[model samples]
Target: MDVPNKKTVLVIEDEIVLRDLIVKKLEEIGLGTLVADSAQEGEKLIKEKHPNLVLLDIMLPGGMNGFDLLERLKRDPILKSTPVIILTNLSTEDKTATEIGAIDYIIKSNISLDEVALKVKNHLQ
Candidate 1:
């Protein structure tokens, strides 16, 4: 049930290098991308763009963190269905992430950029 022109992924990360790498990788794979350096901006983008998926970082600079944003997204009727993948170095367990409604948890240090692209591809499919 792929909707025409409905492929976009929003990335919420504060790290410049990692965020750029992710944006590049996701774009190279042909998925549209939107980015936010903090959860507040991410929330705004999510409301405006309605991206198909989200790559969320646990720690953020603004008042709200990724976990808080995740909880809010899960509670929202419109956003609850969007797939979210936790992309962070935080020690938050996979169980916790899943319980919070994240589709997957990815450790930035453990996976290559291409591997991240692969995971995104799998989730998008």
Candidate 2:
């Protein structure tokens, strides 16, 4: 059963270890989570679940990348307002990410799992 009023965060990442760590951190902080390995799956989850926030990775397995998904989200009338935080190893894409409509950009290597969880908590507020 779903927890009442629990905010769900969708993590779109291809790295299994990182994705699992992220989900674990978020869950430890009392948040619900949904995960996707590619942009297409992420988009599907966004449309269906309408999660409170999204933690997206830049490089994905599918043809569509995170930027592509971000653009699509920005263009969608209903989903445009959904908050997205770019969680990737790329430090160069921060400007492009924010300009493309992401609320924040996180460089995975530079941050700890605890910090990531804290950032997500702050964004959820």
Candidate 3:
């Protein structure tokens, strides 16, 4: 595919390797990317940069988990409408993800990098 325009995506992931991989893929496809090692980091970027979308992980380090971050985003009228997609190995909380307005709950363990990029791009569009 041709490189996408400057659609920015915030990736909130704890695993360094996975986070880098996702960022690389997003960049390769021409989507501007931001990396946040935890939900707190993601939130800070959201407030400061306000990316077009976010790929959020369910489990994260620090007091602010992904769901906690989602709750915060939902409460903030300014960011409540920002699109969020849940990309996590934990599927047990799919219900909560849906209830909290995640555009999609992706299981990383069973998906390919290309597919992940495709899904993210689709939502960002």
What residue runs in model 1 are displaced by over 4 Å at the alpha carbon?
1-6
Writing each residue's lDDT as its tens digit, candidate 1 over 1-125 gives: 12348598898999999999999998888888988999999999999889889999988897898889999999999989989999878655667888999999999878999999999999999
Count backbone overlaps in model 2: 0
Given candidate 3, what's the lDDT at residue 16?
Answer: 90
Cand. 3 TM to true fold: 0.93
- Give the best candidate by lDDT: 2
Candidate structures ordered by TM-score, highest first: 2, 3, 1
RMSD for all candidates, in order, please: 3.0, 1.2, 2.9
- Candidate 2 wrongly placed segments (more than 4 Å): 1-4
- Candidate maximizing TM-score: 2
| Clash-forming residue pairs, model 2 | none
Task: Please provide, for model 3 over 4-60, each residue's C-alpha lDDT reduced to its tens digit, 9 standing for 90 to 100.
Answer: 458899999999999899889988888888889889889999998888889999889
Candidate 3, clashing residue pairs? none
Write down the lDDT of every candidate, Cα atoms only.
0.89, 0.94, 0.87
Model 1: lowest-lDDT 10 consecutive positions? 1-10
lDDT of 1 at 66: 85
TM-score of each: 0.93, 0.96, 0.93
RMSD of 2: 1.2
Mark the regions of model 3 whose C-alpha exceeds 4 Å error after superposition.
1-5
Error of 1 at 25 (Å): 0.8
State model 1's lDDT.
0.89
